[model samples]
Target: MIKSRRKLWLFVGLFFSVIILLTLLVAPSRNQLMSGSTFGVAPDGYAAWYEFMQERNAPIERWQKSFKTLQQNYSDNSITLLRVYGKSAQFAVSKTEREWVKKGNTLVNLAFQGRVTEAPFSTSHETDFGAVKIETTRRNTDSFKAILKDDFGAIIWQEKQSEGKIIYVTTPYLAANAYKLSPGNYDFLANLLESSGGNKILVDEYIHGYKDKETQEIEETSNVFAYLLNTTLLIILIQGLVIVLILIFVYNNTLEKKKI
Candidate 1:
């Protein structure tokens, strides 16, 4: 009985140890998306940019609400930076946001395709990062015609709507972790920010599926196994019952052996 009990405990300990090892090894590689919240450390995440801003003591805010919601609380002295990956079908900057931008607050929306409804402009070029080039647009109004391109001279143009600006880049890789390593790409981003002339910058995280504090909380709970254990009382109760049963059985068997 003693040997069987010891073996059972050994198996349980090994099971838990394996679980811990797998969690540590696998968790880091999961749920990471490009253009995710700047807080994430994934290769596609903007964590590097977040840390860079912090190091520079830049007055930056991560806006986790929808564009409409953010416009409701918009400030004229700040610059809004919105990055959209994949397709631009579902993302829309509300008229309120446009009105907010028209009030002299700069809004920079970076995406691969489509312009804000307020600015009806399109680019004609291939998406090539190997040879990046840029040019100023001929229809430039309020300097919105400025175009960024690859070395291949593909036009990545900028469009203007009132006082706000919309920049359409071929790829988001310029700000991504792997591509930001290039000195030219890094300088391009720095120049873009410097030109915005707003000390206060707000980055939109809502479009990346992290819409609010509640969503963030859910992500944290889902990622951590310790959180799961703490929140599930039934599992704890079952574990306690199993332990109690094992102890009771061992005690009763010992008592019976002594009588023999």
Candidate 2:
């Protein structure tokens, strides 16, 4: 009787394990939870713009690694779009990134909330993009040029640094999915990028929690479990082994019961 009960319990466990595995395989993805990511479909995401650029055959790429890695294989006259929120340490521009920009690359820094470290310098100048007019608050400076403005003052400013330039747009909304409602925003961004004379355009996805396999490997060098978890084939093999083991147990229990 004890043996029969044990067999029943094993069978039950096996059946539930199979069900759980199947459920996991068919479960809905949680990519939507990742805001601002190119894979995300959220309103704040750049998926739409990314797709649009791909469709246009534009020389654009999603940068899924760190700026330090980017520097190792740096391309001259490239444009990098970096979206910034507040002045948090997580999003703070590193010294390496600054150096990368100095090497004849353009950095399009977008700050939607308009809260960031003060620009190197700026000027009281009015610049308009189609029907959208932008104004600068600070006194006129030779190096800083205002590109867009609103009642809140200069929403976009450009500053030259060494061989490259940094264009600060006080609003990330200009390139977000919301731009679909306003065609002018799309035109303004397109023109701005084109005018930058960058040979390639790179959207920084590393800041949005997307990292390449090489990056994951570097971060998880000492973690065997993490390495196994990241291997799809190994995971599938492990699941298959669990099912096979359950089958063998059930078969052995059935023969033992028959003998009894």
lDDT string, candidate 1, 37-89, tens digits = 57656655667866776776767778776665565665654565656353222
Stretches of candidate 2 off by over 4 Å are: 1-33, 75-79, 84-90, 113-143, 150-152, 222-260
In candidate 1, which residue pairs get closer than 3 Å at backbone N, Cα or C atoms, i.e. clash? 131-150, 131-151, 132-150, 132-151, 133-149, 133-150, 134-149, 137-145
Instruction: Give the best candidate by TM-score.
Output: 2
C-alpha lDDT (0 to 100) for residue 11 of candidate 2: 68
| Cα lDDT of model 2 by residue, 101-185, tens digit | 7878888876543444344333233235444322223322334677765334456778777887888775444556755565555
C-alpha-based local distance difference test score of model 1: 0.55
lDDT at 222 for candidate 2?
59
